[model samples]
Target chain A: MSEAFSGPVAGHVPVLRLGDVLMVTLQGDLHDSTAQQLQQDLAETITHSGATGVIIDISGVEIVDSFLGRVLAEIAAQASLLAARTVVVGMRPAVAITLVELGLTLPGLRTALSTEVAMDLLTQGAPRVGVRRESP
Target chain B: MPEHTAEETHGSPTHEVRDFLRRRREQIAQRWADEPLFRSVFTVSRDEAVEAGKAVVDALAEVADAGRVDDPDAAGFSGVREQLARMGVARGRAGLTAAQVSSELATLRQPVENLLLSDIGEAPAEHVRACATTLTVLMGTLRVVVMQTALSEGEALIDRQRLQLLEVATPVIKLWDGIVAVPLIGTLDSARSQVVMETLLQSIVEQQARFAILDITGVPTVDTLVAQHLMKTVAAARLMGAECIVSGIRPAIAQTIVHLGLDLGTVITRAGLADALKYALHQLGADIVGPTANGTGHR
Candidate 1:
């Protein structure tokens, strides 16, 4: 899928279609501007494609500062509102360190090792709920 | 030999007086050369001694040729003796006193003294003082340069450390199928919060998932700053239209959150991974409709 916004600062944003799933790979630094562009692009892609699930591949990024992380979280929240599932893929070691050091945690976020694994999980059958407990 | 009047007094007595005068002049010259103070001040080596001797002899010859010594009592050696004494006093004040220099020469003997006179000569006080000052200045300059170099190296090291942190922070993979699972390990500060936020938001848009599971079992504790950042993330997620489910709340973290009075009112929180997974399944409309024993179900 093409980027929602294009400019000198925009890096490569690749869109791939696997069966009914649509995967977008984000490469390089995802600052505020970049995140906005990605959000715009994803919104457009989702509107037209009718893909069941979407995956974001971020293996190439070395740093994910607070602003960029917020953008990603917002994207997931927005996409869920539109009835599409979102998955994040491929976090490097440095990014992991910064996240922990900064004490910043995502409340309800899913992660996969690779884009293929994420796609498999997304297309899998419904999740099994074993039991239900009444609220105390 | 018979003295008549003063005008006739000459002859044999004159010859004896002349010899006495010559002896007195020689004695004065020898005394000046032997004086320790004078020798130390001048630091005269063999060449200087030879030259001084030749000059004295030449002056004496000129005086004799001029016939200035008509009588022994009138001989002019007193003036030369006074000049030598003055030279000794001046040299002594400059730390070139005759006694000290003579002792040094005695230890080194004639050969070394001759080398010093021919090559180095006597060092003046002004020259010595100037050399010392120059050395001090150079040493100070060198010290400053060394300190500056060390400071620059330290700055570079800090920069490298920050870069290394960034290298480990970027997230590359996410799965947002039925549930969103974010496994967080390590302390969370403001800078890292941004990274986590970006990764999760992007993952949500890409995966189109309904429920997000944030597992923080790896975290040891939660500080105020970190807690605030988490709250911000939850808020941002809501704005994006995704539901955030926090899992893996350690007991200590729960206590801290309560103690700090952090309001996590809107976000759903679970105590462990199993509970979070159950909630995730339910939120995705995968609730078990018909249950067989042992958690088996058809949605």
Candidate 2:
């Protein structure tokens, strides 16, 4: 799982393509420019590769300011436009808390516990009701 | 001659008051032992009251010697301020208000004044008046210190109990695998809602639960602030990769939410904790079917 993303590094953040799905793992030191470039590269890859899903693993990120939160939300928005479902996986509890505190709930963004669950949600043609999304 | 030179160095009535207190410590303490402040606090024994009285007298003398007779927060009064505050609290517990305790402290100056005036023939009359005035000023400062510390002590105690209440009220329970619930009881204030959100998020990570349920059936009301807080908590859970379900929105609360024009868009809601747990189990692919004929079934 640690070496899941081996092929095709895009900018500082590695964007790996596995089968029909694209994997992008974000690190803790993801700067403003690095995230922007990853967004651009991810959008291009999704279109070119015709990937059905984009799974972004953000477990390593400890601090997420409003800028990163907005960028993540935008990335998901872009992925959906490219006809690929984006599932943000492995968001740390602290990062979630900071994003919420900053009033950035990233509305309409899908989240999964891990890359395995993300793959399950994307690959399995189960009823979308199982993956419930609610805003309180 | 050395003592005279030392007294002259101060060049004020503070030194005279300090010496007078030290010289007449025993008599002053003996008199103050009967005052309400000392008498109420040292109820077990008269000797104990006298001993406590002597300590206060010594602190006052030190303050006067340091030329800070008018400053209640002088380093010399540090040891006795907390003790006096506690004594004031005891007086409060005994049904005497702070004003009464201060008046009791005011009565303390008379005995010291008598001791000072008794030797007025030896010292000049003007000098005796100066020492008496200094004593009044010192006692006034003591009153302010007593009021300040006692009020703060009461506030700190209330703050602590409130924190403990919050901890006891919010309990995050693990309902099943990949599911956690916080059964919140009582009204949801802004401060309390903050605690609920933090506790739920932490429990989700620790249990690695994919589903989080917030059961607010025990909550009495749903005002705008509380509804807003609930909204924030739900959003936070989603960001952390856990699906949060808010359950137990009673009929009245549901109506109130709509009337207040509050929007809980995209967040899941259920009728009660049972329903919330059922939804979570279903999402986890668990069926709640009855047994066929063995008279056995999993709930």
Candidate 3:
């Protein structure tokens, strides 16, 4: 969270805005502070950029400790509250096993095998289960 | 019995045993072939048993020469270890207890000792006793080697059978364009359940399947642990961007699960394979309908 205070100073991991969809690709070993900052940044970007969807690519990440898993869940939850859908994509087989063994099922998060599928899901509106609507 | 061989100048037990074995190798092999252990294994040909016996004698002699006859890892034992393990397993299958097998091996030493008595002409009591003790120690080590090898061989065989069992137990089959199913049979052990999860996930990825059905129709029982395993697999499949549905939960098993207070709410389950397939089909906006009266309604 020092990174959150520094404001993108260690901006190694960039959250790209693609046609109103935010794409965050996590690569290699992510520091705890980096994940915290990313969570903050994603929340802010979803609010400011008016992005309707978020795609988190984790193919390059070999391990997802419980902290990172909770962070991913948090990112999805935060995006949901802001009326943006989040589809995590490109999760490696090992990472899935580790997360499942760790009991961090990331209950509210949606996952896709590939980025294209995630993008497709992001584009489709109210087509499947787990679709959330804002309370009046 | 004077303690003297023509070649004995008060040498070590290793030297004496090695010399004695070399001199009486053929005679000892012949006697051992008639013993129950070799006799049972080499039932086809007596010559075959004699050859196996010769190999063992040679290994023992080599070990004694190396002065490592008491060590189970003695290099000489490796040659005969596989054959010894087979003999031990066969004996075990024949309903002989381990103590009985060890005693059977003790019978083999008597023939060699009888020869030793003739070889050591006019030998001193102390020298003769030392030679006999060395031979006994060597045979004891051989018994240990056989037991260790047989135990490990048994474990390895079980491991192999388990792999084969899993191969037939869990198979991921594609049900539709974006759906797959795994019909798990038998019991849900920790190892097998983990494999079930892995194979289900792999099928989901390779087939790009949006839905996976784990049909446990053939699984006999459902305990709290098994329920937890099913939930874990469902959760894992979801993490891989697929919805996992557990089906074929017997009515009795379902009641048991609820009684055990297992929370299966996270897992979407179906009554049977057909129901699971129907649920998946309906989710995919597809359905099955029977033909109407005129055979004109088969859509």
Candidate 4:
């Protein structure tokens, strides 16, 4: 259970494979080089595990610059190329406001509130279809 | 006349300078009245000008008699300054400029100097110089008092304008029953940010809004500081039990965010106000079913 937490102090990104989903939780401040390395690691993990979905939890990261934003988008783009959907979860309200303010929409990147929501979204067949009413 | 007590000798100038001006007070008043600038600038009747002139000459005589010339800070100047300040306020109310007030003070110097130098002929040279210096110092102090009062009035005006700008900057509008939106425009400095947060939270509690949409479509640029302010607004709304959705994420801003590599974790964002409203409605379990979709209205 906690084995996933134990890894090299630096240059370490925890990637857990749960069924067909690859869960990656980003913690601490990620340097430009560290973010680039994680992009590579996520792509490699997706290929080897044959995961159909990627959930990135970024609740711990307090700051996101343009480099980090690009890396996250790149990871999503890479996952999609491998036939996997990327759902970034646990983004703090501040981080979202900042990212949009910086002018990066992370096109094609799907977002969910929490890991459970992301998992549920992935399990569902289409974009969360439920009781929807029409405004007359 | 009351007895000339010892206190008069100590309390008033009672010096040669005081007697010189008092004996010729009418003459100095006449000279001041004859000055064209005083008559034209004051815009008062001939009698009013002479009355004002007499009062000023009398005030100077009072100070000179007090023997307070050696120390301008002496209590004697308080009475002098108060009289001048009264005159200054009246002049200000009459729409007089600072230049006119100062020139009026300067004009008094000539009449007094002429009286002291000529009327008190054969007086010691040093005594004459002392009287002249005392008059100059007193008049200079009066000029300062008048300007200070005017400056304070100007500052009060500026303070009012700044508050008005703050009120105009943050406007939280109610869009629907449970939805309120703050359309922020212009720079988001710390002062404006504080206003934005306070107004949004108050609106949240007052309207009991379940959803708050902060639209920054008019914000020229999104920097780290601006981002921090938005985060604070959202957190405050959440504390009030309202969900905040940021909208107006233009393409350029989107590119900048990704390029900056800022991670906006799970806070929901929409590209425009309409989308954010739609999402808010959906969350509220209400949907806008367009009339055109069913083709019922067209028929």
Candidate 5:
């Protein structure tokens, strides 16, 4: 889980491909620039790998400011465009409070309690009644 | 020469004043009892009134004996202030108004003056003047103490009211077996939100509720801050493993949210409490299944 990414750039978000699902585990504080770069990298990975589902584990990120919140939403929106379902997993309690306080409700964003649950949600195929999903 | 030696042999000027007051204690107290205003104004029992009057005279004597007659808050006058404050609180609780107490205190001086004049008839002119001045100053200190007690009583009342308001503002109610709703009213500041969050979370665990509804209909408006407070509450509930449903979005509030472009994320929101409850019930896997004798049941 603590493995580093050997990509061209240092501190680049590690995007691991798991079978048909692409898993990106976010750790520590995410600066605005870091979020922006992650957004671009996630979109590119989803397109090149042809992944049908993208799971983002954010249990490690301590604070989700408005900018980072927007980036997460953009990632989810972009992944869906590339025919992939995006599920954010493991949002901490304090992070959730800060996110709401920032007034970034992450509207239309899909979330799960853990990476396991996120995987379950992805494997279930299609979202429930009110949950947002990629249009068929 | 005899008078000067008598004064020098005595403890101090305060000693002379205290000696004079002690000698006339019974007389001053009797005069206080005889005053028409004393009986009319004081709400305590006749015996208690007499006792309180005697205590005041004794306290004044102690203040004069300490020799710092000009300073009411002096350490020497502490006992005097304590006696007067006790009298104030006792009379206040007995339904006596501060005005009545003030007027009664004024009448007390008349008796002391009469006693002072009669006692001064034998003393030298200079000694008489010094004693009168000390007694007058001590009386003023008593009055200050009484006023302070009145202020403290009013402050206590306001503090209790604030607590009552907090209790009334956030009420956590069990809407169903596994659902709790916290109806928030009034302003939602950081303080009130903290209380709301604590009460809701505690209720969730106690009721083992799977769903919580935060009905904000009583909340008059939805600004960015208010919306943020609501969002924080929902997030906290989610952490507790209970689904949160926000209800009571008026037309004006909906407009405000859209105008601000605030994203509530995927937190479920409904138009009214009933709708939120309906959604909560569905999430709990409970169907109405037609109203039954035992209320409703889970399918």
Candidate 6:
């Protein structure tokens, strides 16, 4: 079971694996259905593997609307609940604007320039967990 | 000039008949002073009163030539005198003295210089009142028409402006697998942000998608208020069971986040869409790799 969790399957979505860090690469568009499947698979992986962190790669996606952006944030929250850190990598410039406009920021999810950078950050040490101040 | 008695009236030429109709119209217009509705809205100004007085004197000349009155000479003279009196009153209201009013009226009655000057006195206020009522009606109608036109054009302009703003602010795209993407490209002012939020929420519920990604890579900067709105979207997504990922953070934006002292410590941050995707897959355990790696680069 652990070996099967090492990398993405041939027919399934592509995910990158580097030692303790797992990276999933999303290609094409991410709407509600795709986001749901991604969330379910990620949650199971965190629960089963006891892996410390997960990284999502979105370099191939051209456009991202509000719905897809929300999914990414949800994954982070879910991963945190399962005692795993979530990181997203390679977001496009246009995608960034849409997310900000939609106000879709993940509270604690670590974002990186690339999968390699994300993996590097995860493996180096305990991820710096910044505490959010409660809004009065 | 084979003018005859009453029997000849029936054989009048077309031109004569037309002339008769024109004279009848003039009479009706002259009698308009007695009509209440017409009088209510029209108030004749001093200039209009003087012009009308001149026109009445001119018409009397024509009527006198046709011998329509029993005593044409006396009637014509009396008509001129009456007009002069009316002119006097109009001039008085315009701040003219009795002598000035008389001089002005005399100049207007130049064509009828032979008219009797008897009974020529300052015109009664009622004459001015009648002229004023007629003028008021004309001005009021004109004002109503102008206002209606302006209001209609203003509404059209507002609608056009609204459409232009929406076109500039929103970008919609449909991808494969029943997924639709609506990219918001601009600074999310509070108002614009609300529109984006409402649109996405409606689309997700309507489309019933399993995954939704909100990539804000085009965003130049994110302040605390923007960050808070993002948090709200994430919460909203959860309620629908649709996954939401935030992607794209320029170094500048990240710096702003830190500088603004926003503790997005609990919020998921993605450098770009790729990273968000990788993390998303890992969560689903769709990672073919053994459970050794959690699929997210963050440890």
Q: Please list the Cα RMSD from the true structure of every candidate, rounded to 1 decimal place.
A: 24.8, 5.6, 5.0, 12.4, 8.1, 21.0
Stretches of model 2 off by over 4 angstroms after superposition: A1-11, A47-49, A125-136, B1-11, B296-299
Model 1: per-residue lDDT, tens digit, B148-224?
33344546668999767754754534442535677777888767777777777677656754456677787778877
After aligning candidate 6 to the native by TM-score, how far in Å is the CA of A14 from where it should be? 42
TM-score of 3: 0.88
Report how far off residue B264 is in candidate 2 (Å). 2.7
Every model's DockQ:
0.04, 0.36, 0.31, 0.04, 0.09, 0.02
Per-residue error at B260 for model 5, in Å?
Answer: 5.9
Worst 10 residues of 1 chain B by lDDT: B11-20
True contacts kept of each: 0.00, 0.60, 0.45, 0.05, 0.09, 0.00
Note the Cα lDDT for every prediction shown: 0.57, 0.84, 0.86, 0.72, 0.74, 0.53
Candidate 6 lDDT by residue in tens digits, B1-299: 43344225433222232233244434433343333322322355434433453454344444434534223233434444434333334444567655553344233222221121111113233433332333233223322322333344446668999777965776544432223355556776777766666666556545543345667887777888788777666555533334566778778888888999988764566787667666655443333244336564422
lDDT of 1 at B218: 79
Alpha-carbon runs more than 4 Å astray in model 4: A1-136, B1-123, B292-299
Q: What is the interface RMSD of candidate 1, in Å?
A: 10.6
Q: TM per model?
A: 0.37, 0.88, 0.88, 0.52, 0.63, 0.36
Docking class of 1: incorrect
| Poorly placed runs, candidate 3 (over 4 Å) | A1-10, A129-136, B1-8, B93-100, B291-299
Between candidates 3 and 6, the one scoring higher on lDDT is: 3
Ranked by DockQ, top first: 2, 3, 5, 4, 1, 6
TM-score of candidate 1 relative to the true fold: 0.37
- DockQ pick, better of 1 and 3: 3
Give the Å shift of residue A72 in candidate 6. Answer: 24
B161-233, model 2: which lDDT tens digit per residue?
Answer: 9999999999999988789999989999988988999899888888878899999999999998888888889
- lDDT leader: 3
lDDT of 5 by residue, A1-136 (tens): 1234433443478789998899988888765666777788888888888899999888788877777888888888888889898888767656665665666666567776557656766876743222212211
Task: List candidate 5 stretches off by more than 4 Å.
Answer: A1-136, B1-3, B9-11, B34-44, B68-103, B223-225, B256-267, B291-299
